[model samples]
Target chain A: MDPLSLLRGLLDTTEDAARALVGRERIRLAVTGLSRAGKTVFLTSLIANLIAAGRGARTLPALSDATGGRIRRVFVVPAGTETVPRFDPEAHLGALAADPPRWPERTEDFSTLSIAIDVERRTSLGGLLPERRLTLDLIDYPGEWLLDLPMLRQDYATWSGETLARFRRGVRAAAAAEFLAFLDALPADAPAEDALAKRGYTLYRDALRACRDAHGLRFLQPGRFLNPGPRGEAPLLWFFPLPEGARGGLADLCARRYAAYLDDQRSTFLDPYFSRFHRQVVLVDVLGALHAGEEAFRDTGDALAAVASIISGANWLERLLGAAPTRVAFAATKADHVPTRARDALAALVEHIAFGARGRAAQSGAAVSCHAVAAVRCTEDAVARLEGQAVAAVRGVLLQDGRGATIYPGEVPMKPPEPDFWDAGLFTMPEFRPPRLDPAGTSGMPHLGLDALLAWLIGDLL
Target chain B: MSGRPTPRVILDEGTAPAPRLDFGWEVQVAPPVPPARGWSTMALIGLGAAVLVLGFSLLEAGNFVAAQFAQAAWLGWLTLAVATAGFGLVFVAIGRELRGYLALGTVDRARAAVARGDPAALRSALAAWQAGLPEGRAKPGDLGNMPINAACALVEAKTLAPIAQDAAALGRAAAVQAFAVTAVSPSPALDALVFGWRGIRLVRQVAALHGFRPGIAGTVSLLRRVAVDAATVAATDVAVDAAVRGLLSSRLAEHVAGEAAAGAVAARRMMLLARAADEACRVLPR
Candidate 1:
């Protein structure tokens, strides 16, 4: 390398290329969670902080004097966008500034952002003291993707049969059966009927929801089936032979279409999703899963292992397509639900659920780490005294009757009942939503350990 | 059970491949096959070769092509016709891989923009963001990857050069003073610069290994304390330093240092980030 050339490269531009070069590093990060686990909210908040840092505004404790400088600029890129993800400072700041802060909207698919930061270089490194710009790309996606991973292991028949069976058992099945009967009335070769099609689609979605409610299966998006694009047209549904078929001809056609649906699904959703990601964050609503009962817990354990199996076996598919995720983070969401005192116990529960799957990933040379986090603070405080006994409760704003009121939401039961308990009902009372924090409490609720999560995943980029 | 091995089950040479089994076997019909995809690697290599040739030709001919075209109307017309044909081919290729190319380019640009600074790009981005702010279209999150902070730093350094140099020595002192000016608070730009770098360094270690650094462990423990204890900055600084040192020391060997050297560097960066963050806090209008 010519010193003069280097000098010229250094001096020829005022764009701070020198700083970027000095700061350049690569790190991969994945953010994911179960359905409605506040993945999107956490992502947006983390990004908001990063963007706020860009203005040389806001103070982040981790980035304060003891650590280093804060984030300077932020960019968020939607998966298909030309630019990186941007920190929507307005969205977050506005929310924070509101009389009562609210969580960001949930995300349905994968979103990513690559952030760049320029730090003040320390003088002792024997080089020019130009500030270095470090860039980190943080990737966020739906936790549903983790659920779909297990489907890769099942053939078309198995997936459809199991789903159909579940639908038959659940309360939503009556409506579904009616819809299937309607399917029986349609002619096999008749022109597409919009009304019938809509009914059929409704049935599929309803059945999926039923399964989700009763069985805790989360991937319920209906578009995956109805839209297979040009190549998939009608033939795909042949594999998922609908029981709606009353005659031999109808049965044959249904079988063919089911097959097509399965094939299309494998090609579209299963393959690319596993292949594209370089790392994965599997957010388990373990408490919710646990609360669902023994069967639910067992189901979760099975599902997680099943997901792991597919990922490992999909090596062939990944090789055929591209790189599989090199790392996996099996995170337990709503860590804040427990009193801070029992966070370790919550972590232990998560560790038990993830141990087998994580070990498998490690055996295969893929990196796996576990974390317990609360994307949105459901509780303001770690512990509360209820009826004179100290119970772990979250203190935050809640709805009393129809008005917003302060309340101490009771602690998650130390041991929730069996799987049949989910059938009982969701936690409808305001015990989960606590009292609104005063100005002092607002600082950490929206994001906790998000920085450390960011640090662990893509800190090298900065 | 028909013990005798039923005559239908007996093998016979007469069966003889079942006359090639004309269940559409020899019907001259095509098998069900997906449409062939484009030869990507071949095309890319060819395109690369073409670019190389064109570059070499330009270097060799210098102003020759322009001069030739300028001298004759017929020559210019011929050139235009060739250019049009080339464009048509390009359009066809674009149609084939337009989405893929766009996606690749987007990722590439973001990566390049982050890895290296392009002032024109940064200025354009900054202007867009500033303009987008009022319309509620601007996303501050973009600052994370835009290198805009660095650009702002440079802008501050450049703008404040005369101001800083007036009271100090020229050149180095001016640069140092400019950096100081950039550090002036309420500028999340400087805060991000310091924190983002250390954050990246931290993430790298975490991803690389479990317990990769003693610093992370210490940091985690410190964070545990902070979760419950609202300690002042002075009181917490010691714990922070210890944690940062532990983290930095973990990466020392592979990252161009022994434990001591890495610790020093870590201490310096942590302090720098802390200082900048504090300054931002102070300058943040209450």
Candidate 2:
């Protein structure tokens, strides 16, 4: 056996013994977006790719290879307890296997999956081992939940007054004003109703958007209170509204509820998320943000900052107070969107935005790294015609306005470990969308980085 | 009444000498109450009274000068009698209050028992009972022994005053039960209480019928058998079912005596109800 694989085997045996002595390990992952950010599709694909790695065909190179550091096996098992349902591997896998790929339905109210995989170590201690089991505890939830974070920090009157002001000045103010009026009229202790809460939730959501639009607040979920999960439950989610009185009154209520909500989110979402893993990989769709222009880019930055806050805030902070993440890889996803030659530039852009002041809170400690990856290869290198003219294009899968347009967005060069020069503003085109990329040929596997990321986090522990 | 014949009675009664009473007064008799006042008063009065008496005697014996102090003897006797009587009253008052407080405490305990047994107050009472139970301190396989009454109370609480209680308990219960279901035998009865039929299906999917071999699965299989036995008893016992339902859903029923009969009905109903509960807990994507 190779040295990396041998190390992995020792880790696996140790991990098995640990589980026997210490019960089960708990790990968590969180995926979110501001509205319509393709979170569902990305998550579904990430998991599908992870599971398909061992099938030989359409495998992730990082997970299936023996020589390189990679994951050897992946299995979807029961979550923490048998009372809850097992993670639906078939549901996600089936979606990826369809003739025309489709995104999995969005998840709400944080869901968890405990996945087991055998991962090979990148560094060698000699050929005395084979492979070890590395468990990944994944969590998925709606982006709308992020809105409640800021609420936890602010009171109702302050939240409301500020929201009202945004309604008066921002783009969605007209709709926001009407929704604000409805929220203002709600009885403090009354039972929540879908009709009433819907209006209020929508207004609050719109207010978030309006604030983001005007003053560049990053947490815009529900886009306008479209509801994160099943309706009715939305109202029960305690959010801080601007306090009605300056001294106390409604502010206390809002603050109290906000604290309760924050606690709930932590126990239910945050705590369980970080329990099982030693590393983290945060995926960002840089192309989409670039397409949306400056405001979207700024929102993405703020969103990264917010992500940092959440990781370093009360929830993640309490668990990892002094012990920071052993390894963190902040990835710019969907690298196929850019030409291979500029893949490094794309990675640089993501690194700059993700590690900037806004994302610093989340970036602290650990060996932070960045990458550009495409889980599913869309196309190979080739020139293509566009707009009745020969343009420098690389062949790629593209879903163009509900139709397939086989066009090369551009050629992507195999990236060096550290590139010499790069710029973020080079790609200025808006309205750019990937045509439905066909599944890559059954090449051995693609992307070794995913497993390397996992190896770095828990390789020693395993 | 006259038609019935009166049987002749033969008395074998004979006088039996009672065992010699050897009761020790020191053992049975209560300790004597402590003196309320110091010994100085007794000594001073006794001395003065004796001195006065001695003077009187001296006068009677024709000692003229000592006869002048005779009135002082009556005054000293009066002071001794009054101090003894006052000390007695203080002990009596202290004894009475102690008896009253004990009586009050008994009454309170009886009232709590009655409240706990009341169908109207069942839900909250059961909640109080479970909260008071040693749940968190339980060992790995200990959950199988959770009383059926507590489970019944939970079901009732969730179904009736669902608004009052938050989801914290349900979530914790879910977590604990999850451990039991996965780590122990997948007992259908406990499964019904935890997730119902749907949960059983999930168990089947995640765990091999034989288990994951050396780890938590082995622990689970052994615990599962024990849980099943307990569940079977709970299923047939009406009181057990009521308690289980109360503990699980917080619904308290009126009758506690016919629990065996009630449990039979409940166990049957649970076959269907548990499936629904499990389905309800499944989270869907937006």
Candidate 3:
């Protein structure tokens, strides 16, 4: 470690920092969604289409300048990182290209995939200027995990009170009845013990599961409680919301554990990873929530509002470190579930549901856009005749029974469904299997609105 | 699903319905994939044939001049004067072909400057483009208000869009003319002659509209550069489409309808070439 060498090392670090401040070389795109909101499929399709674009077939038409000729080449290259596993698009693509063509497996942990886009920027000094390299560092994390970052703001008592209050309200009461009975039996000031903590954690988790799995709720929070990462259950996770009492025993113990949990997350997840996002995409399953009836729909709307604010209002730490996402895209995923004509209504519905949040995010200087996207088009538009008249419908291989079916899923309502809308119950939707794909991956997948999303995300750079 | 705020389902008061934001360019417009197709033997053959014809016509004129010299003196003098004028006219035509190259070069250099983003180049390109505007046009849509850089960036949208659009219209018209003449003409030779003339005429008109006046030879050169891909399409895919249409129409109508499909196939190629020519002439935002 000579003094000259050390100084040179410092200078090298300085140049790298300077480049990172303004260089458009490596851009991190953070993508997350709710549970089963199609996060894995979206990332996989995005990578596959880009790779195909390299070989002459590109479905990304909105990126006119890039796909038309400006892009010299595009390919998914393995990212070199030690912290997280390299994202394997091949495995996901293989699953979708399976004989029966199934959806890819859900994201279990964070992964990184790098796409190298060699762009010929003719705008500044056409042929004489060198080609620019843009590496799209795509960060894919479990949709169930991102929502937990927002939880760090609240302490154990505030969170406990809110959870208890939710349990006492509307449809949650019935879903959490067994949990509520268990809560009523335990005294808040009971002595701290491993068995008691485990019992409470199990009961509260079951309640969240019932609300989500059985009742089709969207926003069950402390998302780690639902999908507890690769480590499964650490000791700190064995805490649950409790009724108010003297703050001396069990309540104090749980509060300490909650603080420890937040500290662990802040070091391992927030600062190093989430804070580095240059752009963010929040995917919402609005159609699935709509199918769950009014209660679930409203619940989803609340979750989106919270997310919008969080996206726009990055904590002071993230902002100070220049990690606030400059642009945020709210995507209504699985758009192939609806007919093409009604796709607009589907976007409008989501917009109206979260209008306030979107406007605020935009005001806060994050370029916000809403889009209806189908990563892999699972259905084809068809005219289904009912009573000797034609109606808009989608025909696909239904996931329910591995058979082809045409379903007129009804007009996606322009605004939120009217009061008593559930009485008709006609807006129910079913999922579909992935479309067949080329085994060798030469042809790009047919998609809806992904080009628009990509264009908004990085069209200027191209 | 519980403890959510009471949902307020209401549209905006008196606000218009929001515009559709699902703009996927793939569905709205199919981008032109003009693959670089090198000059085929047919193109070379056409050029060679054209050169031979021109050579023979000049030789015939030479022979007439020689014949006049052997006739009566006054009649020979009159014949000599007419032949000399014809030779001068051919030279003048060649000069216009040179002018054609010059005019095309002016825009090409300015276009390169714009791409380079040189401030001086931007200003020069602006002046050159402004000078080329059609008479009585009201400043070509806000170019007068824009800064030089801004002007060049949106040169296509503000200045060249209308020109490109009109060029497209002309392309379509030429295509229709080709289709009509091909369908009605009794001979395949007539169809070929008419299509070639129409394509040449379109190239000249489109180039002239962008401020270049090329002679027949120059027009053909420009045509070759722009029409390479279209010619390939006509040779390959368009023929397939025409064949499909021909088969479908054969069951529906008699003799003439079958040729109409082939006519349409030729028209499709002409339209594609016209589009390429339009793009080839545009000045900025490359």
Best candidate, TM-score-wise? 3
Q: Count the backbone clashes (under 3 Å) in each candidate.
A: 89, 77, 1
Candidate 1: residue A416 Cα off by (Å): 9.1
Query: Which run of 10 residues does model 2 chain B get worst, by summed lDDT?
Result: B277-286
CA shift of B23, model 1, Å: 77
Give RMSD to native, each candidate.
Answer: 30.3, 38.5, 22.5
After superposition, the stretches of candidate 3 with alpha carbons farther than 4 Å from their true spots are A1-17, A20-24, A65-68, A315-321, A385-390, A426-428, B1-286
Candidate 2 ranges beyond 4 A from true positions = A1-58, A62-72, A78-80, A83-85, A119-131, A150-199, A206-218, A221-227, A237-240, A243-260, A274-277, A313-323, A356-363, A379-402, A406-462, B1-286
The C-alpha TM-scores of every prediction are 0.48, 0.46, 0.61
Task: Write one digit per residue (lDDT tens) for candidate 2, span A77-181.
Answer: 544554433445456545544444444554554555666665544445212233445556666566556555544445455666765554555344553666556
For candidate 1, the TM-score of chain A alone versus the native chain A is: 0.66
Residue A197 error for model 2, in Å?
A: 7.5
Candidate 3 Cα deviation (angstroms), residue B151: 50
Write candidate 1's Cα lDDT for A85-104 as tens digits: 44343454455434444544
Error of 2 at A214 (Å): 14
Fnat per candidate:
0.00, 0.00, 0.00
